[model samples]
Target: MFTGIIEATGVLKELTLKGGDLALRVQSHNLDMSDVQLGDSIATNGVCLTVVAKHSDGFSADVSNETLGLTRFSQYQKGQKVNLEKALQATSRLGGHLVSGHVDGIAEIVSSNSNGRATEYWLQAPENLMKYIPYKGSVAIDGISLTVNAVEKNRFKLTIVPHTAQETTIADFKVGTKVNLEVDQISRYLERLIQGQSSAASESTLTTGLLAKAGFIK
Candidate 1:
């Protein structure tokens, strides 16, 4: 689990294609590497990546084909900047909403505009994932916890402040940029509960056709 709070911005130093999967080496000058160990998980651009190897500057992890196809990591090139966050600790403060670092789907930045000291961006999400996003809901965009300012059709709005831009990779966003999106974990759980109950109700409904088919009544 994670807090969706970006600790630092890291640069992709190398992307080596080992066999069929790719191995990534990220270099970060700001992120603390003292406590990080092998097998530890790091949220990289909202995707949970396990640390296979660690160095003084950064760490290296392997990316599977499924993750590559589902995320923008496939489009990433060497030297690209990425947001970084360590896994949440039991004693860590819950500053942001719970983020699984599991990318639900990718979203494309449709538009952006300056809003005084902040920049407001509108992004179009995958059609099936839009129902999980609600106005004023919490979302993790590329591992940065942000609130949904508005929702229109299949698009949602986010207001990025100067601090956020300077601290993470939000400053690099542009129209047509693809980003990993993780909706509120609670929302997904609630949806599952509702669906489960609906399914049970439908199965228990006794229609005349169902009764006749089952030979229970005629």
Candidate 2:
């Protein structure tokens, strides 16, 4: 599991897609590699990938075919910047909400506004995600946890402060760019609650009508 918090940024070195498996190599100077071993899971742009190899300047992970089909990581090109986060440790703080480090789907950046200190990423999600995004809801974009600053039709905006931009690659957002999106987990819980309430209401109404016909109640 991850907290959707980005720790650093890296430049893509290789996206080797062969035999239906993807091997990504990226250069991150901030990641302390001295302790990282092979087979460790790292969150790359919100996708939890296992480390296949490690080097002084970078590491590589095998991306499953399913992950490639579902996320924008497959669209990454050489030298592109990407968000990076290490897997959550037992001792790490749970700053953000529970995140599986799984990319549900890709969302498109509709617009952007940049100031020197901050940049805003406006994105349009698919129809399936429209009901999940709400005002002040938590969202993970390319693995960075952010709040919904504003929402439009199938669209939402996130304001990236300078600190967040520096830690991740969100400062480079541009129109038409694709990003991995994960909605708040609480939204699913809410849906379940609504379904349960509807079921209870239907049963109550049926019982009431039966009782009235039998003269047990008016």
Q: Write one digit per residue (lDDT tens) for candidate 1, span 54-83.
A: 999999999999899888899999999999
Candidate 2 residue-wise lDDT, 76-135, digit = tens: 788988777888889999997777787877899988887677788789999777677888
TM-score of 1: 0.89
lDDT of each: 0.91, 0.80
- The clash numbers for all candidates, in the given order, read 0, 0
The count of backbone overlaps in candidate 1 is 0
After superposing candidate 1, which stretches have Cα over 4 Å from the reference?
197-218
